[model samples]
Target: MNNHFITLGNLGLCVAASLNAQRLFKDHRAPAAGIFLVVCSAALSVLPATISLDWSSQPAALCADLQWAAEVLSPAMVSFGFLWLSDDHFTAYTLLTGSALLSMLTGWLSRDGLSVMSRCMAMSSLSCSLTVCLFAGNPLGILGSVLLSAPALVGLSGTSPLVSPEAAGGLLKLGLIGAMTVGCWAIRWALEIYVQDLKGWDKSNNILT
Candidate 1:
């Protein structure tokens, strides 16, 4: 039971990594290949979990039929992940775009020690931003997303990285993360305030039980 949750979380991370890769680089090839791998791995990992979900019942029936359905549907679900990763570009769009972005901004990283710290903070923000996007409405995910905001605020105040566009783009990424923090809080608040009353609502405590 615990393994299922862990595997599901792994699937989310892989899918999110694939999506973030495409977002960062705009390259379809790496993300497409990654999606294929992720889908295969996800099924190999999650099929067993689905069977375990049946244990919530009196006597779990054999999951042969469900497993077969999962097999048939897994390819399409994997394709959705692929599409989510690609953003629909045919060529190496993400890679090219991300490369261009980094190239256009490389000269501006601060040589100073204080500025280096700022850069580190910005990097942390970027990581948290993606975590927020990956987790969507989850409170823990939203907390990760909130962490991004602090770094963004720090980066904006501490760095002067505008001589080149590449560096500027990096700074912009940090700023985007700050923006996402607000979005994450909004979603979290919405879920807490309005969604809890829904009929099917229950805490995640039972997910692993």
Candidate 2:
């Protein structure tokens, strides 16, 4: 089916983004950031499958439980990563712990269905992540966070002329995943250019000296 292919494509993109993150941040300059991005991307890669499981008829209870857990937990990893990149260790750790606990609570409370409280919690998490990305001064991170969170915000708004309600969710998921993939590659390209510029500057300075 077309939907299945689309899901697989999204999954592949997330996985590729994860690998790119690993390579980009492998340097000592941002090892923690790299780790966080890798973890987040990996989680995202499987998210479609998890979401599918959640929607499937007569899916195993265990799989459904795992889906919700992953949904609530993975985005925090990205937030923590961006916060760490900004050199805000205290806030990062505090928020990481808090989000983890909240995610667990959300999972427990919304076993049968995703409740309003759980949706609010997710929105709160995305808002926090977006704020931190803005504060951190990384354009790519900010853009990625925006793309990543836009779906939740739009869903909450409850209406869109561009997309019918029935098809909106799937389209939003694809858009989010695609945006994340593009953002990762863009960040990687920017970092590469920066490093090259630094090396060139260093060479010029050495020559003058």
Candidate 3:
């Protein structure tokens, strides 16, 4: 059952990656760097599953290290990538980058999987959602943002003595995958609406001229 959930989550990541790619290609104005990061993050997130399934012949230590590296890097990469896609300002990018780095360091130092990294992921997801809502002024975008942030928030707050850490981790992973998939689709929807509005404005201006 846990493996099934992981597989589903991986599928969600692939879907999110494809949606991001579609958005990137359809909108030439979209930054390639952000899309590339998102796609790379998605791919990296799935590395553990792939390694476990196909790299049985390889040294276990090597596979474990590779998977650990991917797990550590993926959340930060995806968070920053979404932030960049929503708001392309240098200050915002710098701030997010710094926060991500700090979170990574904190996670490494504490050796707690759920400490700094999960909080950072939640906050970054919220920031991305809020940015999209502000730019597009869409209610659906706001709702989607809440949904995207819900998993991380829940994971942070809902840990209990009754639930095993492994179970919690698995559920959190599933939730994060679903959130990412929803977030990508929501951002794409907002961008499409914003672009259509711009086109309408341009047509109106041309007529007035």
Candidate 4:
């Protein structure tokens, strides 16, 4: 129950950011600010993944509770990254490589390089989105991760000075398609779970009879 609530909260933040970014892009003409908000929300979404229970030494249960909340709310980014590094699986390596690439891109767009809010925010949103997706554990998490980043990618490419308009537009379109694809997969997974539950119920009824 706690885990589900946390996941929902993370999804909520991403949705709020996406909506704000869209408004800024279309209405306010300040897509940079919108992109920044998305990046912040992404950061929040991953907060659980980075939390430490260091305060547990304080002899207070509050700290333990806080740690629990953090674990529930955030994805396990570090642990997943470690697994990617330690595991010999090709899939793990691919995710890790992708995450590293995104981090490099984010670093390249630091304040000193981009020197503009729009560009920096765009880079951040892209980086965070990828990281979120990399750390997702399940289909619902995957949907949230992809959807959160998809809009940010479009917004980043369209507004950031670093990207050529033509290239950025193409990337934006691709990201949108990817997001939709992931969403469909999530729905399919959900339906499968429901069907399995029905099957279980039927088997139980037959045994009881």
Instruction: Find the candidate with the highest TM-score and give its number.
Output: 3
Off by over 4 Å in 2: 24-71, 111-118, 151-165, 168-170, 183-209
lDDT by residue for model 3 (162-190), tens: 33567555876677656656755664565
What is model 1's C-alpha RMSD?
A: 19.8
Q: Model-by-model lDDT, in order?
A: 0.36, 0.52, 0.53, 0.39
TM-scores, each model vs. reference = 0.24, 0.56, 0.57, 0.26
lDDT for each residue of candidate 2 in 82-166, tens digit (9 for 90 to 100):
5555567887777677756665664465322344544554566567656764654456655655554454344422222344545
- Compared with the true structure, model 4 gives a TM-score of 0.26
* Full candidate order by lDDT, most accurate first: 3, 2, 4, 1
Residue runs of model 1 more than 4 Å from their true location after superposition: 1-111, 136-155, 163-209
lDDT of 1 by residue, 134-170 (tens): 4443453344334424323334322434334353335
Better of 1 and 4 by TM-score: 4
Q: Is candidate 1 or candidate 2 better by lDDT?
A: 2
Question: lDDT value for candidate 2?
Answer: 0.52
Name the 10 consecutive residues with the lowest summed lDDT in model 3: 66-75
User: Candidate 3: TM-score?
Assistant: 0.57
